[model samples]
Target: MYQKITVQTKTEVKPQTTAHLAQTMTLLNMGNGEVEEEIQKNLAENPALELDEINRCAMCGSEIAFGVLCKNCMNNQLKQDSQYLTFVSTREFPVSEEAADNEDYFEDGTVDRQTLPEYVLRQVGMELDDREKMVAASILTQLDDDGFVDVDILELASYHHIPISSVERVKGLIQHADPVGVGSKDAREALLVQVDELKRSKDIPEWTEKVISDHFHALLKKQFSEIAQQCEITINQVEKIANFITENLNPYPARSNWGDVRNPQENEMLQLGAPDIILSFFENNPQKPIMIEVFQPANSNLTLNASYHAALKTVDKETKMKMREDLEKASLFIKCLQQRTNTILRMAQVLVEIQEKYIREGDRYLKPITRAEIAKKLSVHESTISRAVSSKTIQLPNRKVYPLSVFFDRSLQIRTEIKEIVEKEKEPLNDQEIVTKLEKKGMHIARRTVAKYRDMEGILPAYQRKEKVKTK
Candidate 1:
């Protein structure tokens, strides 16, 4: 068993250059943007690379060197497109009964809505004498979106150099404000304040009101039978009382009424075009006939001068070696830049072919796609796919295009078949209706799940889509 054994093998491997090693190290260290910056820097230093210009319109057969579109052709295209659709003014219209009702409600002053601080100040102003307005204002300012003051009354009093009793009195005043239940130091107090308001309005019976005011924890935990036994009321009565309490309570009472309305300054138009990469997609065969015109170093006017070479020949050995090293580095950098551009172009072409449906049909047709899928198709790593897509955009026939990254989204619970059913329905389907329809179609789904998918698609809730009939 202990007999001697010998194994012989021969292998050959190519030695990597210092420049190649340096490039590997650089690529490992830098991100996509940094790599792009490095490439541009190399191109500038080399004086060898040049980005080719697209001189003709692919569509109209016209010369358009400086820009992608010819002036005459662009104008004609715009004119033809303009005839298909008309732009509308942003004037207010009575589009829905609910909207009309909302208009009438505001006109009749039925709903008393106020800004957070204003509402707080009104109640505090009423309760507090002129002496404590500053303390009340300070307390109101400290209250957060949930209407709960983060700082303790004593802490606020210490900061303001006011008596703790004054802080408490001001807090009580804010707690009694309209949109009932604001400036409470805690959730318990907020809920109690709301229950008290409901009690005053006689929204619930005396026994049910007591249960809500006292045993809020039991109600929250859905301990309806226990609450009913304690309050000597039916389970049904407890449920009704709980609903009334929920309806009355303002979870974020100190939050401004105008919270739903966005400020115009916040609105921004997302520009979706990459001017750097000149891409052209051929209409007939998009799969194989796409062109990515990258900068070619050979096209540049740079050449090794005869005088410089003659001078170098007469120079010292050290000087000649230095010049050679610089030339080699410059040449290597230009090569690396070209390689990077080629990689990006290859990735883009693959993406266009795979996601052609999204480009042709629009956003509604966008399916659940991923970088992994593209990487597999392109014979590259997932990281490479991510790098290729990052900060890169494509120009399409319809408009200036965005990165292919924008097209890929997570798949919704609503399958393609379910979506088709919803779309083909004569009437708009609410979450519940959609859920019911899905169940009939043998797709097991909950109402909440349906609602979530609708939300993901940016579709509104059933109540929002409901329309009123016109009556004479």
Candidate 2:
């Protein structure tokens, strides 16, 4: 089925004379793991393709003098202020046969692990138009620990100045996401949404929705006899419905597969591997040039097979044509790989410069930036920048690894402020009070947005916080 779909999609694309352009664009969006797999597959399938074990310059193909790049390439990239010194690294490559099994390259594949919100966004991003992306982003960012929207839907509709129905349409799309009931208002809503989804494919009991909607309280309290009487059904029927709900439904959308929402600290998280890029200062000095190391998974350069080229020259005409096709493919793959590396390097240079303070200082200093801003600086499309940053991680000098997308996170500063304000509050401040406080600090945002950010940081509501204070 997967192959059929892939073939169908490929058939839809018009034949292009510029193979390099099409291939490079495809390679640009692939994560490191996917690229490595592509390289390996090419090497196995094409006799003309070869992997050079020697570490060499990605740009000039010269033997690397010291690091990943030759001295000349390094000098050409260096600037007077010395703000950034970015280069690709081959440290992730296996050094010996024994070490290959446990090398960093294998582990680095897992760095693209997505949080729950991100996972959902990937599914829905392509389906949404530009305006709907904003609405979707708003909804996803506001999800609480239970995967329910923390803000009022009407408030969001008013804030975005869109019709309430549009908001519902977007929220409806989210509710059908992986956990199957996320973006719901509460457990009952989530369960009903789940049941609705289940009815499409499964043999669900017809009275399941009725029992949940009309007698949710009684259902929870196990008043099966009363529910049976109200619905004109036998107690045995109610028990069967109860059994189905117990076996197939989860009231908390985030509780299954997701981390333990009840214990926010115990959220299940995937272990991250080596970073795709490392941000540091030259000579480990703050005043020195900033160094960015982009990891090359193969830890080596790819070159054409000289033996195959020689053999091609002496082959029959038909054989020569076939081999030449292989050679062209191999050459194109290498060029695309280099293009991918260069694109990432260019992006990193701009990001490190724009986010220098945020990197050197902390989240409090994060300036509002967007992918469009970076794309403009680089003379590329916004989607190009998005593809380069997607699923990539960067390790800072402080040794904390963060997603490459973090550089473009416009909300980080405000979210940090919200967290700080809550941490130092004299008493529990409601969302409106927090909004007023933010306004005093010159960070004006809607009360609902404040609530969303608060929920994102796992901060309790004012009443909950006050109750906890009383307990203390």
lDDT of 2 by residue, 1-472 (tens): 0000010101222333456755665577666777777778888999998777565655545565444444654676564444466566665532334324434325444533456667787777887776676677666654555677654678767756778888888888888888899989898999999999988898997698999999998998799999999999999989999999989998878656653223332211223445678888777888777787777666336778989999986889999999999998887787677767877878887888888899888998888887778878777756567668766778888877676777876678999999999899999999999899889989998776787678767899999999999999
> 110-175, model 1: which lDDT tens digit per residue?
122233554557655866665477566555544443566644677657645678888777777667
Query: Cα-based RMSD of the predictions, in order?
Result: 20.2, 12.1
Once model 1 is optimally superposed onto the true structure by TM-score, how far is the C-alpha of residue 420 displaced, in angstroms? 7.6
Q: Which stretch of 10 consecutive residues in model 1 shows the poorest summed lDDT?
A: 1-10
Judged by whole-model lDDT over C-alpha atoms, candidate 2 comes out at 0.73
Best by TM-score: 2
